[model samples]
Target: MNTNKELEYCNVAVWFDRSTLHAMMQALVEAGLNVAWKESQKQFRVTVYTQHGTSDLTLLRLNGAYKLDELDYCVRDMRLALVLYQFIEQAKGHAIVKMMNQDKIVVKNIRYGEAVRIVEIKGAEKKVIYEKACSVTMDQVIAALKRRDAEERIPVMRLELDYELATLYDAIQAKDTAQVKKSKDRLKQLRQEMLLLEA
Candidate 1:
């Protein structure tokens, strides 16, 4: 808890899931912040240089939580941290929109029919039927948006399970115990989550 903000670093941690954490890191990187992922520590080190001084922030993940560390608590550093937080919030919104769009699929099912009598439709027609059957009213839409806003939301990362499994295999072949263990745990968790999502 160094209060001296000038030319110093401070660290804080905020709770975030893997995707939100990754989005924040990506946003910091896009904003020209020097960011590095410390794999061993499961944290991100962010350094920002200004004309007056240098500031740093570290994001650590632990027990499915996240925390941010700032180098200093000076006005400048506080301002920078605020900006970073805003950027993260913006990124989170973007991620939510992306996830919603990706998950929004045209429901294709028979309205009323047996196996012998059915119709397959997609796109606008499917949407119409779905909206009618589900009674997706304005209140529901509002409620859904509220739920999304309140949730710790993140877009699905591009990283695929197959790629992660392959990396795990490589780690095993290389006899990298730490990596093998990490990858195996991640793959197991991710696979379970994916199955749940699919269900």
Candidate 2:
């Protein structure tokens, strides 16, 4: 109900189920914040206790729509904003992870080039969000998918090397001599490729 201009805080309007919104509030409560939901106004009043002082925030919710003001308590409050942001992100991430695990979403393809990389993700709605890879590797993509945190990116070469190393370990554990040999050779080659890229 509050306008962005009036709030003057980083915030987002999201439509989600009541259960999902409750889960986010639970996360904040678990992090040592006092939260109370007011049915009359359909808002949540949150009190954050810090070493310096206590801060308060009001999260407006109606039906499935919700808005959380990041800088509600303090102007330009990076620390408080980060804490709330991380909680919201983690909640959203978990939901995405569940969807991916259930096959509701899928990664269509990944194309890598000299200067850029492209990742294509397809959801149940048939909508796709194309992400440009900025040093993002396949391994990081896999990790992000599993964790539901797509914003975390790392170098492609490093990811490839780590994957090969992991494969080598797995082969060793399985006592598959052929696989171990193959993984070792692949890892060696990856290392050389990484060196060339770095140079």
lDDT, candidate 2, 1-199, per-residue tens: 1112111222232223456557766765676555555443677656665444666666566444444534223323334444544544543211111113233433322111121222233453564455443544666445445653221221344456668889889989999999999988887666444423322
What is the model-wide C-alpha lDDT for candidate 2? Answer: 0.45
Best by lDDT: 2
N/CA/C clash count, model 2: 0
Write down the lDDT that model 1 would get. Answer: 0.44
| Model 1 per-residue lDDT tens digits across residues 74-110 | 4344445445545434332111101012224322221
Give the lDDT of residue 101 in candidate 2.
27
Q: What TM-score goes with each of the models?
A: 0.31, 0.32
Per-candidate clashes, comma-separated: 18, 0
Poorest 10 consecutive residues of model 2 by lDDT?
1-10
| TM-score, model 1 to reference | 0.31
